[model samples]
Target chain A: MGASLLVLMIPILYRIIMGPTGFDRILGVNVIGTKTAVILVIIGTLFDRVDMFVDFAIAYALLNFVGAIVVSRYFNRTVPLQEMEKPKPRRRAKV
Target chain B: MKRTAFILVLLIGLLLAWAARDFPAWGDPHSPASSSAVSSHFIANTGVDTEVPNMVTAVLADYRGFDTMFETVVVFIAGLAVFSILRGGPNRRTRDREFVVDFEPDLIVTNTVRLIVPVIQIFALYVLAHGHVSPGGGFQGGVAMGASFILIALSWDLKTALARFPIERCFTVAALGIVIYAGIGLLSMFLGGEFLDYAHLAKVFPVSPEMARYHAMLGVEIGVGFTVTAIMFALYAGLSTDGRMRDGL
Candidate 1:
């Protein structure tokens, strides 16, 4: 069950690299990260070694989170060139 | 191109499945995992090490507590990373609009959530307390508690829901939990048991060695539960708020 999910990674990575739109690439990366986390858990089960792999899975889950956040933060908004020229606001005088 | 890639992946999957033909069946009684050194440690020590009944919990919170402490830390770091990456700066505008509770919230869900929140909280504590004797432990309970927050989020608007439990305090608590765990470990060293040794606690209490270990395990489980719950909630907050905007979580 887990291996099949990992196999999907190849295609996802391919899309992330070749997709024409930034949105597609971001979606692909997020999907890949989610799958990576599940795969890590399965691999931990596969080897029957709980010590390091479970920790690695937990860590990888976090990494996937961080990756998703960083990617999202990157494309959240694009500042228009005109906005850069706005004058700074003056502080209000204290009563 | 899609077809080509699909076919490639299919072929690879087939090859991998064929190779797995010789692999041991899942949960096989004779599998090395069931018989290995690590499993042996749990099976052997569980009976005498602590009075707790759950072997897996014992392993997670007791014998291998050092690893568990770091695991909580990992969760904390993940929360901080998410908060730092996506949260608006302090000077940036905060969401001012009140999160109005929907009037026609699903009747079953609204009532169920209201009723179940307390039950779930009790269940989490049960899992934490019985970790030594049961299958569920700090991590499982922590996630369960986190799910309660998610339930709250789904019931109400994010702003109103989050106001009840601020993310910043959650992060701080998570960090503090780990610091407390480490402090105990340092205290253990002073008592002349290895770092994180609970034997000293027993000595201080004039209790049996076994009881000391049990007490120590409980302390660590508390930390694990705190950190894991806080971090999981933070991650859920981050993902739900901004995944669609910037990247998919």
Candidate 2:
């Protein structure tokens, strides 16, 4: 089962590399991130250490989720070029 | 330029791949690390010394405890570094007018988060507590706990997340984590054991030395977890808002 999931990651990798839009790339990365968790579990099973590996899988999935969210939120903004030009007042200056 | 970059990447990749051959094969008993008497002693004695089933946890939190303590300190420093370097405080400008965040909270995402946050937090606790018998420890569990908050921020807004965990509270909690770890070490010292010696804790608690180490390990893990979880959220809060606690990305 994990092997098939890993094989499926090849297509996701292709999308991450070749996706036309940034959103497509993000989606591809997220898919691949999730599959990596599954792969970690499979590796754990191979080592006869599923209990230890399950914790890893859970942590990996959590990190993957946070990474996707951070990326999406970053791109969610369209910062105005005009706003970029205006320097806000600097309050933390020292004499 | 893109082609040149790709070629360089492939070159580096192939170099790394070539270098991988020197690494000892997986689980090779004769590997330098595996064959060392130090590791041999650890493998033979961790159960007897610590009464801990998980060798990794026993070695990490007990034997090389000073290293792990410093590692937690490193994590604490990382949180501080992010705050000092990236945090700009909440932008007052964002208060007067609408801050542009190109997306709105989708109902589906927010609702899903509401349902799953409890489950995630509970699982994080399980992972943190179960480290002795399993693969997890403070770092993994802390990241999981922090990730749930990040998810809340992602699904709703930073404001909503902060309502549950304020910025001041973030720093306080982070400090508390380190103190918990160090306190255990200090207590052991006062009890005539070396610093971080869990066996010393047996004097204070009415338990066998072995059981004292077991429980002390759990306490130390929780301390590490606390620091990590706090730092994780604090880093997010700082980086996301550019230090202005308002209107995060």
Candidate 3:
């Protein structure tokens, strides 16, 4: 079951890697994070230690939520997404 | 340059994989680590010695406690270094930043976080207090607690979080944590045991020596929780605001 969830994350991983917009990447990462919590729980069930693993899953979920919020907060405006794909002229380093 | 770096990384990765092939199979009884007298002693006697069902916590907070105390100090030092480096230089806010976060807090996010923070904190305490019987301990609990504060900061603003846990007080709490850990150690020493010898606590605590060790482990864990919780939040505050303690990410 955990293996299946990991296999499913491949698409989300690709979305994260090839995402056009920053928001797309963020959403992809969030999806993967949520899936990871589920996977943790599945792993716990396999180990026959649901009680132990559930704590880990909860902590992982909380951290995942906090991470997504931090990223969204950092990119508080919509300007960066529009400008992200544009290439800037390279500046020479001053010696 | 990029190609060279990639090749270098590949070589290192291949070397690491080659090294990993020599490692013993998972949980192999004949593995060097499992066969060692030290590990066998811990496995067989941890319950008898400390009454702790979780050997990892017992080993961490009791048998090898001196090391854990120093680990907490290392965390404290890392926070201190970050705080000192970024704090109170000329304000860098005058310089243009790549991203400027808006001051407005979202109602939905804030409300949701308000609902969630208490649960997270209670769980943190559970993890801290329940370390002896399960997998959690001070470090995990402290991180959870710190994350709750960080969530508040994120949903609202840095100022709101700072208002709840001020910067100066962060250091104080951090130092106090170290003091609590060391104080217990010293008390044990004064009670006729070596430093961090929690068994000696049985003399004053009116419990069996094993139970004394168990309770002392909880005390030590609480101390570690305090330092970690404070330092984690402090590091976040310092790094996020570049130590200005003003507008933060």
Candidate 4:
């Protein structure tokens, strides 16, 4: 079951790597984060220590949510996605 | 240069992999670490010595407490360095920023955060207090607590978060954490034991030596939690606004 979940994450990984829009990548990452929490629970079940693993899963999920929020908040501004792609012009060094 | 760097990284990775081959299999009883007298002593005596079900916590907060105290100091110093370097500089205009964030806090995000923050905080305290029986302690709890404040900042603005946990108070709280940790150690020393000998805490409290160690670990964890929570928020506040402490991400 854990193996299957990991295999499913490949598509999400592809989206994160290749998605054109920042939002697509963000969503992909969030999806993977949620899946990771499930996988953690599955691992805990396998270990026959559900109580121990549940705490880990909860903490992981919380941090993942916080990370997604931070990213979304960062991109909440008026700047276009394309503008972010362009490299900033370098200023000449003073002699 | 990129090709050379990649080759260098690959070589180092291969070397590390080769080195890792010498390590014993996971959970092997006959492994050097598992068979070592030191580990055997810990595994056998931790329960008898401290009555802490979590040996990791016992080792961290009791057996090698001096190391953990210094670690807390290192965290405090890192926060102080970041604050000192980034704080109170000439403010950059919004136009100069890479991404100009100019918007009101979303009602949905703020409301969700408001609902979740309390739960996260309670969980953090649970992790801190329950370290003796489970796989949690001050650092994890402190980070969770700090993240709650960061969440507040993210959902609203840095100003609102700072208003709740003022920048000056952050450092004060951080310093207070160290004082709490060292004070416990010093108190033990004054009670006729080595520094951080939590067993000596039994003298002041009307508990057995084993119970004293157990309770002192909790107190130590609380001190660590205090430092970590303050520093984590302080780091975010400092880095987000480049230390002007206003208009942060």
Tell me how each candidate scores on DockQ against the true complex: 0.03, 0.29, 0.28, 0.35
Clash totals for all candidate models:
5, 6, 0, 0
Top candidate, metric lDDT: 4
Candidate 2 residue spans exceeding 4 A from truth: A59-64, A77-95, B1-22, B87-99, B102-104
Model 1, stretches more than 4 Å misplaced?
A1-95, B25-29, B88-109, B243-249
| TM-score, model 2 to reference | 0.84
User: How many clashes does the backbone of model 3 have?
Assistant: 0
State the weakest 10-residue window (summed lDDT) of model 2 chain B. B91-100
B1-249 per-residue lDDT for model 2 (tens digits):
999999999999999999999999998999999999999999999899888899999999998889999999999999988887764446523434335555578777678778778878989999899899887889888988999998998878888999999988988898898999999999999999999998988887999999999899999999999999999998988987777777777
Candidate 3: where are CA atoms >4 Å away? A77-95, B1-5, B88-101
Question: What C-alpha lDDT, on a 0 to 100 scale, does residue B18 get in candidate 4?
Answer: 100
Quote each prediction's TM-score.
0.63, 0.84, 0.90, 0.90
What docking grade applies to model 2? acceptable
lDDT of 3 by residue, A5-90 (tens): 89988888899898877788889878887888898899888889998899888888767879888888777622333455687689
TM-score of chain A of each: 0.65, 0.75, 0.74, 0.74
lDDT of 1 by residue, B1-249 (tens): 999999999999999999999888987888877878877877887878787766777676667778988878788888788777777675666544322222334466557667766666676777677667545667877876776665565544355457877777778878877977897788878888888777777757777877877877888878888888888777877865542222122
Docking class of 3: acceptable
